[model samples]
Target: MTATVQPTLDGTTPPAPVDYETWLAAVWPHFIAAAASGRTFTCYSIADTNQLPDPPNPRAHWGRLMHQLRDDGYTRPAGWTCSDRPTTRHSGVRTWKGTAAAQREAAA
Candidate 1:
């Protein structure tokens, strides 16, 4: 039987909780993996990355993951300048690219 769709008291369904372990898993969707790989060669604007790599990824919800990856040395900024585009957390977003370490990680 199909489940009936129901709206919540707030007229919206609550967001599903993130499975942190799964989100952190090495094996991700091809798009996410590809984006990570692409970063090694080119920079991507975070604002434009809202629907990146095609197919979709959890990054749309957990944008901070990109910053985490950068902090971990998996990615780096294209430059010191903030993007002209706006974001939820910041007035302007930044561009990022994969680092050599990320390339090696992707290769593995």
Candidate 2:
């Protein structure tokens, strides 16, 4: 999913629309920007004179997307937080730790 461009059947048309953001989650950051959503899929070939491959063009926008995701990290599912880092405050760092723990224990 990192690559948005679909593999080509021949050498011209691309495949169905596959949202790159939703597709590549495993290699995403915790926070993504609105600008990242505007990117779309395109295709490129690896070989200089040989035919292009299907479903994974190295020259397509998808390739760039994957490069961006892999290099910078783009969180998936539109709003899914990046899995690599902790977004919320750590549990032990809370000032009211005892009270929070008591409340959680009582609720349980």
Candidate 3:
């Protein structure tokens, strides 16, 4: 039997309990494995992250990731900016391509 769709009066469900930064890091390997299996996922950005429980401030992980990117010479210098480019088809129809062939396909 189909379950009844009981609409909430206040229109809210319980918040997800995942610790956002830890959740992000823990799932990183899954995202990477998906790539090896010919799928991928979009990434989170510092600006778009949600607030988290206090102490150790949850955004620290993202901060470290950016620092590593900078240290690995993958970022710009002198007050530049970047994007959270989606690298997966599963993220729905949103953006165009990033690289050469992907751009061609998105255009075509």
Candidate 4:
């Protein structure tokens, strides 16, 4: 059976959910750019800054994306800070900074 997207109260259909790999491919470059800035950042901050599309499963996939980036030598944990996401009520979140590899990628 095919699943249908329901229209919201405003009568607009929501965007189709993107699979993890597709969403990651779309947003990776933006994340890399943010990482290359060499400033600490939260996942939400980068998403908001770049207006990235939400992942299919935000609660899990977002963290997965960060871990993948770290594993790829693009970013590293810098410290913890309160999230700037309006809906997050300023909860403590881990922050990341660009690694040397990210700088090299940016320079290339």
Top candidate when judged by TM-score against the true structure = 4
Q: TM-score for model 4?
A: 0.88
Candidate 2: segments with Cα more than 4 A from true spot: 1-16, 26-59, 73-108
lDDT of 3: 0.38
The models' CA-based lDDT, in order, is 0.51, 0.32, 0.38, 0.91
Which scores greater on lDDT, model 1 or model 3? 1
TM-score of each: 0.43, 0.19, 0.26, 0.88
1 against 2, candidate with superior TM-score: 1
Tens-digit per-residue lDDT, 1-108, candidate 4: 998888999999988777899999999998899889888899998899888888999889999999999999999999999999999899999999999888887888
Q: Which digits, one per residue and each the tens of the lDDT, describe model 2 over residues 12-104?
A: 666564454444442232113222333321112111112322223423644455346435433222222222214434322101011233234
lDDT of 1: 0.51
Off by over 4 Å in 1: 1-35, 40-63, 80-92
Model 2 RMSD in Å is 18.2
- Local lDDT at 27 for model 4: 92
Q: Sort by TM-score, best first: what order? A: 4, 1, 3, 2
- lDDT string, candidate 1, 1-108, tens digits: 976557789899755444555544532343245445654322234324534332125546345566666677766766444444344343454556777776787788
- Give the per-residue Cα lDDT of candidate 3 at 65: 43
